[model samples]
Target: MDTNLSNYLKKEQDKLNELLSAYLSKLSMPPLLNHSTKYSIEAGGKRLRPILMKLTCEGLNGDSEKVYPAAMALEMIHTYSLIHDDLPAMDNDTYRRGMLTNHKKFDEATAILAGDGLLTNSFHVISNAACYSDTEKVFLISKLASASGLEGMVAGQLMDMQAEKESISVEQLEEIHQLKTGRLLTFSIVTGAYLAGADSMILQKMERFGNLIGLIFQIQDDILDVIGDSEIMGKASGSDEDNQKSTYPSLLGLNGAIEHKNRYVKQAKNLLEEMELNGTLLEKLVDYLGSRNQ
Candidate 1:
């Protein structure tokens, strides 16, 4: 990855932080509920989903400013998923983003409610994207909902839970991760295309690119869990091994996981280039993914 791309992602990430803070401040709920919700939403994360949404919009000739609300909504959904995933019944993690997991910091009930609030509130943010035409707003909202709901991330999570400690085929693992990790990513890119009124061909290409990157991202996470530092990863490392979860690195050898990640990264870059779209930022984003230390 280029050093310049890392610098640029840092700058773009700062803007995402500002947007998150501003949006969180505007939220209105009962004081206790609001505090619970804010606790996890404000916790630091890489904010990759929103960044991808904004960059995809920019790549397809849409205004990033106009797409910011939708982008932020994506982040909320992602964060909510993380909150829920860390519950004792799920991954049972105690740390996240270098801070206590919501359940650990607060309590399981509060963390559950916080996740619920964030999930419901995410739609409000997307619906507020009415600055665009009714059709565009409707399209984006529907797409995001599908990605976050049953047919997407939820399905993936269910599969993951069911497959824990069991041997799964390569195809099964891919299916699980694609749903668990790839669907929202697909929505992020497709939402940008809808807002920009891009043709079906462009949307299809972007979808392919997003799916490829999403899988690559998961594979990298699996690799990191095996080899990454706990401090840098902000979560327990080697938990996949301890939990006996089926992961790419578990199903494939460590070397195989590295090979798979490199292959997907190459495929993602090729798809982006084939789109012939001005994805300078998106290209940099993909390279950064390939090079991310954690």
Candidate 2:
């Protein structure tokens, strides 16, 4: 993509940051809890999940502003995951999003509490919808909780931990990643449709599209970790290999991972075309994920 296009994305992401910060400020917490929560939520990152939620809502003819609570909740869940993922018990990283990891910047205990705060606060955000009906709010919260909880991201994390230092089949690897990484992404889109009151047919299609993008996103991360720059990626490079984790590039060669990501991108685009969607932001996002360096 051109620099102008990427710059536009950055601009939209900044809008999300502003909204998130405002909502976060309204929540009640102690001083230390507030500080730790702010540390991770305010940390620099792409904020892709919230952006996707906004775009998906727009595509469904829903008010983007009405979707802000769900979008913010999605981002909070994502931030919480990153905070925990960087813990010593997890990836044990010291850097994230081009800054010191939460544990590294704060003590490990503080980081853990920060992650917990974000995760719990996410539910609070989802529960109070300014525009959605009670039923719709419940639906959104249930879907998000399911996607971010035991059956989804958390389960995937457990599988990842278990698979470390051991070789697993490609199918098993994909299953682990689908739950660990893809679940929330899928929820990000599907929740938009649900909040928009989309028909079941459209919602199902959106779910498929989200799943494809989620897998592509994870595959790209695997590829980048092997070849990306630490300065650009904002974390230690080669950590996946250093930790002996099972990754797409480790199982499939670099070229193979590229091909695999392309396949998923194509699948996602085809699904979008089937829905007759006009937004290029999602398309651009898929392209960006396939081609991202960090």
Candidate 3:
């Protein structure tokens, strides 16, 4: 990664870690469940979802501090998804961020409840009136709910699970990602823009950018599973093939997957160019993602 991209990602991610620590510290829940929740929250991650949110807000001359709670909520939602995804009933993974996964570090029941806690708590964080009005909070919560619910992430996960039993076309794969990954990524952009009181045109542009960025990220993930290091990825490599699931590489071959990832990144970068907002960092971020192996 370029120095600028590397520094920016690290800086924001560190900030998020602090914010999450402060927020989670105040929670008074069951001991084991709370520990399970904090286990994954404190576990190191890219914090990419929250950073995407804060950057869009910063681009619009908005205060990131005001958006911090909502940004943290995004990360919580993401972390919950990862915890559940790593469960025995799901991907059955045993490691994340170079440590035992939630289900492994703690009992499966505790991990499952911990994921539930994070998912539901995200709405409360977004709906809080710390940084925005009730109307705006409602808008954020509504969008987030749809994105994380059956209409979006749930639908995508369902498709992924069902596809494990049979072949899926490229079109079906795209639809699965558009809901599963695209909605939340788009929500990251849209939520920040809504907080900043951005005009509808800019919101529309962000919507398009978010969708392409999601595809770029997911396609690259598929490519990495084939050629990435398990140590660097913090999980076993080639788990996709091991589970007999379809992936970009499985459907389109390694070369084709790389081409598609590049195409989507370029499309996202082009959208950044057209935005009136200064999205240099976002463009660089998109470009950087194309080469991110882990």
Backbone atom clashes (below 3 Å) for every candidate: 0, 0, 0
TM-score against native, each model? 0.94, 0.95, 0.96
Q: Model 3, 59-90: lDDT tens per residue? A: 77777667788888888999999999889898
Runs in model 2 deviating more than 4 A are: 2-8
Best by TM-score: 3
Worst 10 residues of 3 by lDDT: 275-284
Q: Best to worst by TM-score, what's the order?
A: 3, 2, 1
Tens digits of lDDT, candidate 2, 176-284: 9889878888888887777666899999999898888888989989888898888887777888898888889999989998898899888898888887774467677
Q: Order the candidates by lDDT, highest first.
A: 3, 2, 1
